[model samples]
Target: MQSPIHETTELEELEEFVINFRMRRLKLGFSQTDVGSVVGKLYGKALSQPTISRFEVLNLSYYKMCYLQTLLQKWLEETEDSLKHSSDLTGFYPFTTYQPIERGRLSQRSFTRAFMHNPKPTSEEFGYLAERLGMEKKVVRIWFYNR
Candidate 1:
């Protein structure tokens, strides 16, 4: 499946940024191999090297290009500093906006949302539901919480 890219007057501005980025790297005498290595390390995936190069063919969406632009900006800032230190400095917390119960409303989970809507099911009621689904009771409990 293909995604959509926006075409507008601002597209020219985006192209200019990509071209200028290529030129800046070339001026620094960095080969494609060098940039690929940097991208690979930045994403912690060796395959991401050629993947970044394929951005030309992919013509990545503006939002995706922005992610690359952010990485490239960091690359420029840290070109003289330690590269290892540039590894994923991000942190994630234990919270999610995704409500598993919503998905279960249609299917996948029934003991929670489906039963709750018509009749509040007891743990034993949920146990039978889980047995039919070939899942454990504890699994259903966690699904209830996450849902």
Candidate 2:
């Protein structure tokens, strides 16, 4: 078993990592939602804004913090590489959204069009649409269910 001192030191390091991660993310002009979306896409795991906020605030478990730190480090490296190579930095990152949509705020036209095409979309379809629209999969699923 590890000593309490070791665990405390680990937590302190993680806290510092979180602070640097947030600073780097902001320096790259990424909002919490943008970071969550990009990280989610990279990891094949959906991360919400609240989750990213919690990570920045060091409210997550040690294991989760470590995992996110790894992901963020990789992302930061890629971003830096892109900046170094690309002359046009406007659209450097693959997952960078120009206009990020707020949660639970879908246009009525899109909703109507999607609903008309298929009232009940499959899980795969819903997941794709949710990521594309910057909405949650559960929200898309619920909308279809309600309509």
Candidate 3:
């Protein structure tokens, strides 16, 4: 029950968020990978560098875009506050250089095994699978939901 005009306005806002997110991330001297890592630390789920890049390019769904915008906005505020209080920025540089673990796509067999084991995993199960698969817990949860 949404109008076309409302949808258009929402798209414009999302575009603006993406532009601002990219600019602020660059100004902070944090790469996409760094932002992803920091986000992972802040939130329990970790996003990958490619996912961060996709966000900057506005390639994700609106729901995901909004979620990431909230996360990045909080991160940006914290980073700015840290810079204001610290005499040097050296402490922040380590995050920029740190590399997150690489995770490839989950195999069909593994997906089936997980889905067959429990269609609706509890939070603890989701966390365990996410850690074992090197994927975000949300991703694991969604996969189960969709299956």
Put down candidate 2 lDDT per residue, 60-131, tens digits, no spaces. 888888888888888778777887898444466444333423433444567778888888788998988776
Summarize candidate 1's per-residue lDDT along 39-125 as a digit string, tens digits: 555555333545466543446777877677767666655653433455222211011111222333434545545556745557886
For TM-score, candidate 1 versus 2, the one ahead is 2
Candidate closer to the true structure by lDDT (higher is better), 1 or 3:
3
After superposition on all CA atoms, what RMSD does each candidate show versus the true structure?
16.4, 5.2, 11.1
Q: Give me the candidate number with maximum TM-score.
A: 2
> Which residue runs does candidate 1 get wrong by more than 4 Å?
1-10, 42-49, 56-58, 80-147
- Number of clashing pairs per prediction, in order: 0, 0, 0
Query: Per-candidate TM vs. native?
Result: 0.39, 0.62, 0.58
How high is the lDDT of residue 93 in model 1?
8
lDDT of 3 by residue, 4-122 (tens): 99999988987987898888778766778767877887677778999999999888888998898888888888778878988454475443323222223334456679888877778
Span of 10 residues, lowest total lDDT, candidate 1: 91-100
